[model samples]
Target: MKLLFIGSRLYDDIDWYVKRKNIESILTESNENAINLDLPDQVFIVPRGMDGPKQVAVMQNVDAIVPLIGIDPPLIDVAHMKEEIEQEHGIPVIAANVRAVELTSNKIKTKKFYDEIGVVTPEYQILDSPDDLTLEFPVVLKQGEGQGGKDIKIAKSMDDVEEYFKNFNQALCEQFIEGSEISIEVLGFNGEFVALPPIYKGETTLEGTHPLSKVKTGPCMVQGLDNNLVQHTAYKVAKNLDSDGIFEMDFMYSPEKDQLYAIEVNTRPNGTRYLTTATCGVNSLCELVNMAIGEFSPANISDKLEYHYSTEIPVGDYNGPCPNEPVKSFDDNDFVVHGPEGYQRLTARADSKKDLDNLISKLL
Candidate 1:
């Protein structure tokens, strides 16, 4: 068997590294050949970035084609274009259909889907303009195409909402649940089967090693939150949406209300998905391949895995920490003590806030 991974250059794509690692793992387990092709980067599905004929040529000879397109919302349409091309060429493209991707990509649409399925999610509304509207204060305003928390803002007043609306073409307003945020990574095979593990992120230094700004950057550290209620909810959502491959679903659990509300769904191996490999030892990528190849046997899957929660203080901003020092303590708000290990810069999306807080408090 032969597999072709359509993605960008390895150095530029950390997620691609995870993909490469899984390819190696699958190869180790089976007698198959695999090759990774770095598709050129370009705006949209322009002809210059990828040669459709060339892809068709490769697909004709490969047993499977897995496109590693970025998880940006706009790119949903672009991936659909590639799917069309691949299917027309008689190659089995293992991808969530454009409809499925679109539903998850657009935050507004995702909210509607969740509501229709009787799944609880934060109450939200869409704004096509910065015009006047009646919404509760302290609402969460987010751009439709936002990932991580980059375009996410907590609007405290109507004036704040209007100002944020002026900053973007479209925005979403949702009731803010004051609670801990959790990212659930799910893997579905053939759009009919699914598995999920809860990845918990507390807080981290604003600066230092966090990679929230980059695509597919894993959090500093993560522990599996063995909450079956959360895990089951994630699995149900992925399946109801016909999600296949690797995807991430974010939720904010309100301890005050003891409620969990779905935030949004990412259709690709996003920064949060990196937890399965980088932090936890789930190895979701390897499972993706096994499922893709009809290896969904009972013994091939695991119902439980080791999980951990950090007892370290999460450094949100390490601006003052010594360049090569381990995080010892945050002192005078200028710098933290550095140890022989230097600074342990857990990249943004790296570790949880509590994890950093615990670590820092201990050192201090």
Candidate 2:
């Protein structure tokens, strides 16, 4: 089978799988200097948009297309392209459709969607001005579009809200829930959806800590929260979306209130993949390829599921023993070190908590 993958940033994560499947890999990158360009069978340096990749896919006669984009900006364009190409060329694009992107891309629309679906999300109000704020103090003030904690502020008072409004006129103001932060990856294709184990991100703090800066673990052991509830809520959201590919969602569970509130959804590859893979032994990126090849199914995913204790730590630099070639990617080793030099993370997994601790200590 031949595949056309857009964006080279995430190509390395699934390069081994692509090679193992003996798929002809054609990749397109907007930047000529992007990494992982040499791994694909054919590389095309195209302009920054879906148009270039779409042209290359048609010209090369690729059997399927999978976009490996991680950010939110390019998803709408990719969704548009997927609609046009899949309808006209009869080739599947393993990505979310236009309607799915439209709803999830905007935080306001996502809040409305959750309300419609009866999924509990934090109470929020769209603020045209700081004076119009109705949520209580210690609320999250952010724009409709951003990722990785960009343009986010925890407003504790009117001054903070006013300060936030100085730069942007409107904000999606959400009531802050002091609870354990969680993330789960839900994979869906051809009407089949499976929500993987939820990963425990750190607690919500008044100081507004981004989850990326905290140590995280899988099979979230939140005291009062149930894993099945998280999985069920995620599945409901994904089924409502009725889209293809990965849906990485963020949620907050308040112990005091005994509530699980949906935060956001990212319809692409994300930073949570490494930890999710370490925890469950199911790599979402590789599953995208499975979806492209007509091999993705709920039964196949269930067979591959393995329960393990996993944790990921953010270390500025890693100076540990390497496992093998592509040490950053998953292998038979107990630990996988990934990320750039200055911002690295180590993910370790084992059969038990004690074993997981030992593996992390030995590796770190």
Candidate 3:
């Protein structure tokens, strides 16, 4: 089967799988100098919208399309293109649908969606001005849209709120929950959804720490919160989304209050995939290819699941043992190092916790 993949930034992450499947790979990039342009069989340097990729997909007569966009801005256009192309041309687009993107792309709308689905999320109030604030201090001030903790602040006083308002007229203010932060990845195709193991992303701080800066481990071992509960809750959210491809959800579990609160969801490839794949042998990105090839199902995923203790640590640079060709993949190695030069992270796994500790100590 031939496939058209959008974006070259994340193409390297799954390039090994695409080549292994022997599917003709076509990639598109807006910038001519993007990194992974050479990995695909054919490369098209298209403009900055879905129109270019849509045109390329149709012209190439590809069987399916898989978007490797790892950011939030282009999802709506991809969703729009998915609707039009899938309906008219009968070619599947392996990504979230329009309704799912609309519900998840906005923070306020996501909170309301959680409420409608009976999932617990933090109490929030949309603020037009600092004077309208009702929640106590130390609240999370966020815009309606952002990722990687962008444009987010933890306010301790009215001054903080006022300072935040200078940039935007409105804010989606949420009561900050102090507890362990968890990230779970769920894959959905043909109405079958499976939540992979949850990753422990450290604790929330009064300073509003972003998960990207913290040390993380897979198959979370929180004291009071159960991993099954995290998985079940994630599965519920993905089912409600009623979309395809990957859904990465962030959640916070407060030991003080003994409560679990859903934070937000990213309906695309995310940063948590490496650790998730290390812990359980299921790769969400590879599963997107599976969906395109008509090989995605609960049975296929269940058979691929493997238990391993894994941890991801941020480092300055990597100078240790490396995996084969696609060094970032977990296919034949217990560890994979990724990210840009200065901010690289090494993710490794083992059969037991002690073994995992030994592996990380030796590697780092």
Steric overlap count per candidate: 35, 0, 0
Sorted by TM-score (best first), the order is: 2, 3, 1
Candidate 1, residues 21-89: lDDT per residue as tens digits? Answer: 343211110111212223222112213233542354353465555555544643564456547766676
TM-score of each: 0.67, 0.98, 0.98
> What's the CA error at residue 55 for candidate 2, in Å?
1.4
Output the number of the lDDT-best candidate. Answer: 3
- Model 1 residue runs over 4 Å out of place are 9-60, 73-90, 128-131, 203-226, 278-280, 296-299, 308-364
RMSD of 3: 1.0
Better of 2 and 3 by lDDT: 3
- Once model 1 is optimally superposed onto the true structure by TM-score, how far is the C-alpha of residue 155 displaced, in angstroms? 0.9
**Model 3 per-residue lDDT tens digits across residues 1-364:** 8999999988898999998889999998899989988889999999999999999999999999999999999999999999999998998999999999999999999999999999999999999999899998789999989888899999999999999999999999999899999999999988999999999999989987667678899889999998899999999999999999999999999999999999999999989899999999999999999999999998999999999999999887888876776687787888998899988988899999999989988887
**lDDT of prediction 1:** 0.54
Using lDDT as the measure, name the better of candidate 1 and candidate 3: 3
lDDT of 3: 0.93
